[model samples]
Target: MATTPDTPVAKALRRELLLVTGMSGAGRSTVGNALEDLGWYVVDNLPPQMLRPLVDLSRHTGDSIPRVAAVVDIRGGRLFADVQAALESLRDTDDTRLLFLDATDAVLVRRFENVRRPHPLQGDGTLLDGISAERARMAELRSQADIVIDTSELNIHQLATLVQEQFAEEDEPTTRVTVLSFGYKYGLPSDADHVADCRFLPNPFWVPELKELTGLDDVVADYVLGLPGAGEFIDGYVAALRPVFDGYGRENKRHATIALGCTGGKHRSVAIAEELGRRLSALPGIAVSVKHRDLGRE
Candidate 1:
């Protein structure tokens, strides 16, 4: 059921052109990977200046692929703005979207540490310093985004699916909800614009028995949620947030992110994220997946 121009909202798949950009550690790879899964011809880390040329090349060849996604970022150096211009040039065509992935500084630090990768902007500075620089550099790109996603709390799998559901939509809602839980020491997640700190919740890491297990484990999940306000908070929080997501599903907002954090990220945040993901998935019109960022470190 490909959506066509005259088929109305119910039947046509407005041809999609997406420019994916964001913080380096903010899950751009994951988003690109998911768009690939959705059948978009994906190109990563392309310079912004080359966007129009690439699109022209694609059109000239008349390739069979109808959907196209490009991952362009600061790594493209001073050319990122060029890419934004190219996307804007196509905005009136009825099938173009610009998605910006983001997260908190803490999550970005932890992700870089876990992966043992150096920050592009750091060059000789500290990881946190590099993240700050990257954020500052991408400010303009963020403002122009048609869809903005905070990937701080999103796991790789969840980030991928979210890209697909949001940008790859035509008929049904296939949005994937990524739940990321990380530590404060690692810095906030580079992709999460909206953050929920659960540091006040009891720390399971201090408990000798639970130290070995991740928040995903049944024991950890139970222990974290067993706290006084934990369950109640999740219920009300979910109730409040549900409408936003549901509206996105109904209106088909392309890309979105919700991040949850805690002191260590291995327990309370992970448990709550997992719980939230479960609840989001049960909804009739939405798609969901869960990930715990800090769990991968261990």
Candidate 2:
């Protein structure tokens, strides 16, 4: 018998399907970016109607996109209803998950203000009015969300870490990890998985000689590590995180991020991030990478 579009083989190839939808100003882009970082094939602002077709085509192409995230938002114009249909279709298919990102109105407003971008519906009326419409339109979809996120309370690092926890290279032993160390002053790095604040640590910036050097430099690293509670903190911190890693390893957790932050992000946060990366990489398995968000800058 000839296989039909609804055949088992056709659905089997669709390894992972993620339907990305959320409020206009919520952290949809952030979620997409974070997933992309985790090795997913991400399509932003995909017309809602194209979702099923895209997934079908991906299957026919030998599943070129094993892990896929398609953004189906209000940008689809009249095709918005297709998002609802596509989501419903995927729910019936095996091996597919739908995630909806969301946040409070105040948080959405702040995000829009920070980005200085008009909401999708802003062209027709007041920004607030547009936001309200967008929210109303998304109400039904939000209710069906398998996972809902409140970005209002989460920092970039925390958000990234959450994404990594959920979707990293499933069976890969080696995955590139991005460790972002940022300062609270320069507005935290917007793409960190896990963020740890190091403001409590001694400040290398206070020392005239090390003030000009970053934590990457031996002088600053030495000064920061010699702090009163540095050793004790690292010990306790690692102890707390060890279980999480063990769980991730046992469960084959793919992507994960941990952020360390401090006042200047130049000294304490940087040092801690570096140390953390080193310790993490030393594990028998897994890969690690580190980036200091405020290292080069003042």
Candidate 3:
């Protein structure tokens, strides 16, 4: 959505405006892509002061652009020094929300190194110094955010998927659940809202015939599910999670991540997570999907 010469800026309150901001190297680009995929009109690197024009354009365009997500960084060639003033200028004009995406300094530095680009705030100092400046500049945005996602543990694809799940418009209010399976040796999934360990069950890697198969295979899945505590654990965990989902829906929080870890992600964790997803999907007003994070890492 953009304001054209014919559109009046005073009548821009008809459109919903979402301002996406955060520390540099966080995941604004990915989040913008996800929102665009879900049918939102996305504008990138837009200065906060330019929001009125965009909203004006959307307002005059009728319902063609019901939603507009603008990626606004404080360092985008212009400093939004007073986050409050920047936000208040538009809040009374439209339904505005600020989304802040963040990660640890270590993660931001690693990302910059991987992309082989200089940080926007980086000048003569080291990468850490640049991250420190960016974090400090973004502190106000975080404080005023309507939503915040810590991307410290999220990969590009994972971040995109989560954004899509979190912002998609549903026919009715519903909760979205992601069941992620990973190997304990690879460390935990820091983005997970809840985590469960599956190491108590016997390892299918010990069975010669099942060693090469993954949990997606019928035999391997059956073998893992047939274990002593598997069914009981799955049943109890699903029961315990139902109330959590309901509570999230009540609070207007739409997305959740539940991680399962075992010795290796190939068998036990994958099978159990898939089963849990299946059960959760069967409930009313809940959508579930599964991801095997370390399934093929061997």
Name the regions of candidate 2 deviating beyond 4 angstroms: 1-14, 169-285, 288-298
lDDT of each residue in 1-298, candidate 3, tens digit only: 6776457663543567899999889999989987876679999988677778888899888879989999888565654664457688887866789999999988998999999998887899889988888888778668889999999999877787677667777643366789999999898998999999999999999999999999899999999899999999999998998899877755546678999999878899999988888988899888788999998997
Compared with the true structure, all predictions reach lDDT values of: 0.75, 0.76, 0.85
> Residue 130 CA error for candidate 2 (Å)?
1.3
Which of 1 and 3 is ahead in lDDT? 3
Report how far off residue 72 is in candidate 2 (Å).
1.0
State the weakest 10-residue window (summed lDDT) of model 2: 169-178
| Best-fitting candidate, scored by TM-score | 2
Query: Model 2: per-residue lDDT, tens digit, 17-77?
Result: 8888888867778788878877788999898777778778777777567788888888888
RMSD, each candidate, Å? 14.9, 11.0, 12.1
Q: Per-residue CA lDDT of candidate 1, range 1-298, in tens? A: 6655566763233445688888888888877776775668898888876766766666655546557787888777677657656767777764677888898998989999999989988888999999998898788878988888998787776676566566654744544455566788778888863577788788898999998787889998999889989988888877877777766544435345667888777788888888887887786656666767776664
**Where does candidate 3 stray beyond 4 Å?**
1-14, 172-298
Q: Against the hidden reference, what TM-scores do the models get?
A: 0.52, 0.56, 0.53
